[model samples]
Target chain A: MTEKIARFFAENRPATPCLVVDLDVVARNYDRLSGALPDAKIYYAVKANPAPEILRLLTGLGSSFDTASVPEIEDCLAAGATPDRISYGNTIKKAADIRRAYELGVRLFAFDSEAELEKIAANAPGSRVFCRILTSGEGADWPLSRKFGCDPEMARDLLLRAAALDVVPYGVSFHVGSQQRDLAQWDAALSTTAAIFRDLEEKGVALRMVNMGGGFPTRYRTDVPGTDEYGFAIDEALRRHFGNRIPETIVEPGRGMVGDAGIIQSEVVLISRKSANDLRRWVYLDIGKFGGLAETMDEAIQYPIETERDGGPAEPVILAGPTCDSADVLYERAEYRLPVDLRIGDRVAIRATGAYTTSYSAVNFNGFAPLQAYYI
Target chain B: MTEKIARFFAENRPATPCLVVDLDVVARNYDRLSGALPDAKIYYAVKANPAPEILRLLTGLGSSFDTASVPEIEDCLAAGATPDRISYGNTIKKAADIRRAYELGVRLFAFDSEAELEKIAANAPGSRVFCRILTSGEGADWPLSRKFGCDPEMARDLLLRAAALDVVPYGVSFHVGSQQRDLAQWDAALSTTAAIFRDLEEKGVALRMVNMGGGFPTRYRTDVPGTDEYGFAIDEALRRHFGNRIPETIVEPGRGMVGDAGIIQSEVVLISRKSANDLRRWVYLDIGKFGGLAETMDEAIQYPIETERDGGPAEPVILAGPTCDSADVLYERAEYRLPVDLRIGDRVAIRATGAYTTSYSAVNFNGFAPLQAYYI
Candidate 1:
């Protein structure tokens, strides 16, 4: 935990199951990403955690925004981001929402299908649009499904078709996947993107941009390569694929920008074993899947946990949220271990939870309030 | 769809991605369940959809509540439910919350472990507590893991311990599972509960209540047995095991009581295929998993969908929510089919969503507001 966060916790003693984000850490993360990829423009993915404070911080850093909905566009604008600095990034958008974004002075948009392209063309006339292409999503912990993108051939056709419409055939885009570990996955995706770009150029479209949608990693249970390594690899891939000319590049870092900047403090509500011979004790926390840690679904994003009894002997424990629903379990097979002396009411710090925690929290699922968040 | 809900939708024409609940349907469902098992008192599981209207209606109908948290208890009280009609049902709870519930005059509680029972004993002194025994969770569409309940041996020990504490050692409780289909599962669970009761009686503590937790099915994509069938089976199981000494029984029905009473009308945002040869069209709805169809995780609860053009030729489609997150896909492997003529801006009604939809909705995951609900 950052010294700022520790000081905040020690002083305020906020309620348990709350997230505390250090704004200084967020600023440092922004600078690190900018320094790592000097040529790429950073568009902070606002859906990660659209706290007004984070948005204002990124906006002050001259970071562009990749928004998922019209409300997000309004949030960015409210945070002092100009409409020109925002990109409507979600491909599945209502026609009315597209029109609203257009009316709000946002021009750049994303599309993965002909239907979406048509919506943008009809509603946000003359807007710059990028066609998202499908990736294998091979090396990411939370691999995205085929729900968002289309195939390369379809992307090429859609971009070519865009030229015939009122909207500009701006570029091609693809997400390797979230928390992407294998840097080579970027190389593979860029290769397909370069092919699409070349094909579009041959058809006289000449796409001018390449949006390598966010797949940047953040520290979790295991160590990950720093932003510098990812930047070097992506720069090398661009050089290898695009040869002499790289298009205007953009990186939308949601998790990487703010994930490690925050911590969630949860109280151990109960700790007990199911039976006399049960080896694993079930440790119930005040926060859970519905509470905020939705990323822990399927034991995917294992957040590093720390308790007051840390540095003492620990044992394997099945962690769960204090909800009556069975699916509210955070981790059962991930073998999360906690200190043996961890008592009920002991505070547990869940690390790297800033990105998806607060925004994904349910609205009082089991009468538990949404995960409270405080920005320092 | 119920005539009431359909008429409301036609007359009101509320905005897209809203849930419309038929209060009459809810009342009828309550009447049906009560008629089916006159011996068992109904405790509406408040977590399913804790709208104040539903709570008030149930309260007026003399329904008790099975609450999961202190806020739920507050909600019940606000809806005119007497404190005596509320039970603190979640096994994992903070000591402070226990004290709050006790202070609020809640006398009944459920626990699965010694730690939880002790908390109840210490905080809610002289309260009635029931120990939840683990069930196989077989023949359930949403089979619960070993997250909420304990083994039969551990439950007996806990109840025995409860008797020694300040809390009353009420009888046993067990959940066959959510959306349970097998009547024999209740029989198996009751056999274990009877053994625990008899063992406790021999130890000079005669348990007085058997809290059979909710497992009652609700109609989803396919038809389920009516409440009469479930009530009859449970009654038979109680008779076979208790042998004329069926204690004060309680049935906590969440989905079974309200699942079929609501319909979610969502707009089709976009419809497209990945490639020219891709057989399955991807149908994007304005409402997604985060928008409140969270039960569709892993395609477990397939809500039957109806569209304006339902009578037209139908084709297999992959349904997804209109979010940038790829996990928002609702039904991919479940072979969901939509009308071929289903167009963008068309309204689609997801049936039997009254129970888990609105309550499970994220506060605003993708800048989309929580599923708007209208109780009529």
Candidate 2:
């Protein structure tokens, strides 16, 4: 919708349906989160749109990464992020994957099982580990406690075993779910985690870190509170737990840090009437679901479409992707004004697709070429 | 979730995820439909999942394809399918895309615009065409009639204009919609289209082809009927319209023809609890939203997930993907039994992820590799 974005078309390089991120917005987000929680460490959730540019930008802002896969680990390394700055937060990893992370000099690893601890002890005895605690007041979107986390009692067992084995169990971590709406849920998860830490300390394992997993929602749907509030609450809770001597903390915000900071723009390919009520509008966007927007089924993200660069006003239109599925629609109730005389070949912008918008949900259904990403 | 599918993982060979069509069931489906509609044309929508093997199989079974993209054109061509056998059914036009389809000898082009016709006329002189009529069926999950079909008046004008262009314009095509549930609504669309055909013939345009565009639903939910009744009924209605003298009738059955023929076998890696009630289990076996089963989101396709190698039934567990999104769940309120003490390493099988599955939705997120395609 901006002149600079429109100018991308005049370049005549690629076709419709691609993603572009404004680095300025990303830097602003990093600064906001880091500024709010000065004592806590920030680690970008690389799984959320891990473009090389994005990784480089976050690292440049002095943030580390939370990577789950070997490829993601490789991405952080290639982006010049030191291995110590990266947290291999995923449990149930392959031995080879763990070995790869160790080879990369990643000192902080998140773990759950006795088997995993044995694997790490055999592979890298120098690793400083985190024993994950299942501490939701029972409301985290990820009943992570049930599937992945060690029960508080079980966690004490694991940490005590690690201490005896001479493996430095430095931290305790738990995620309060992604897109969290209730601030009290986060506050409760932290409070419960602190109890687990104190209990572990009493059992002769002194904790050096508290890894508060990322679930800070972004400023998208008003149903959930904004990112700034998440930062402030997290800061306040960290003080309660560590009491001015806050151990190093890692906050991995995926969608919250970048969801609103980016937009996906596309071009209208055809506008026709399907029947009396359904006005079928197809945009030959550079960004297809596989390349850009892939969440087209069950739940669709918002596409606040803007027709004109200069708002003559707004129009409501149900925009669908070029994919064949009827569910390929990006918006059903979405209304943005098109120039009443909107024609074919006109371009439009679908806002708020930056986080988990493209790479997170994208799947190449038609074998279309992957979308090209650019930083403005 | 039978052991028949779990064998796929025992011998792990990496390949892209693709639609695996059962030649036996495919032939049966064709015979079944052909038995019902003795005189109708079967045009497969290649955009569903255009693996070359599937394409060749359908063509061998005597079914044509409904293509929407240039790569699809190339796919049909690679299968040795004649240009006459393939119809470019996309109603939108990017001049280059249209020209590619036209240059590839695509005679039957679906147009929703006078401007599109003009472009085809200028670029593809004397190209055979069809003016798609927009439908108003509320039965379709996505009513394509809204986006790429000409209204009755515009349809008439386009027919007249085609007559003036000194080119060949065939009969009309209207896609009732994708995932259509109601038969009466399609009957209305068909009868309306039939009336328009009569009007076009009276105007002396000499209509010949009647393309009832794809929207036949294949049953995913057990509560709905999954028979070929809708396909049979649509054909029967068309029979009543022109009696024994109908034009070359065409209908594209995308999901219905291929959705349930294959299975995606995944393995349960981590089983965790989300809340006290919901289990947050991440089965990092292999299948993902990109591999095709991700479509039925609100209502996930209840695929029978089984253990590898005929292992004895284990306890019932909830399944999910390795992707960190709280929403990345595969089954909804369904139970899956694993090998009693299912651990970090185990395999699970998911049935009926063939149509609109795989071959499209792949993103290099985390380190999860793309799917591997194995055809028998």
Model 2 lDDT tens row, B1-376: 2243344444553233333345556566667766655666888888776777778888888888888778888898899888888887776656787788778888777786777777777767777888887677576554343545667777877877887884688878887766777787667877877787788779776888888777666655443444457656776787788777678878787776776666665555544443334333334444555445566454434555555545665565556566544455565466555565566555445666667666555566565666555654
Work out the TM-score per prediction: 0.99, 0.83
Interface RMSD of candidate number 1: 0.8
Query: Could you give me the TM-score of model 2 versus the true structure?
Result: 0.83
lDDT of 2 by residue, A183-280 (tens): 77667767767876788778776888878887776544345665667778887877776576667777888777776666666777665554344453
Per-residue lDDT of A1-376 in model 1, one digit per residue for the tens? 9999999999999998899999999999999999999999999999999999999999999999999999999999999999999999999888889999999999999999999999999999999999999998898999589998899999999999999999999999899999999999999999999998898888888999999999898999998999999999999999999999999999999999999999999999999898999999999999999989999978889999999889989999999998888998998899888999999989999999999889899988998889899999
Tell me the tens digit of each residue's lDDT in model 1 across B101-173. 9999999999999989999999999999999988889999984999988889999888888888998998788
Best by DockQ: 1
True C-alpha contacts between chains kept, each model in order? 0.88, 0.31
Weakest 10 consecutive residues of candidate 2 chain B by summed lDDT: B12-21
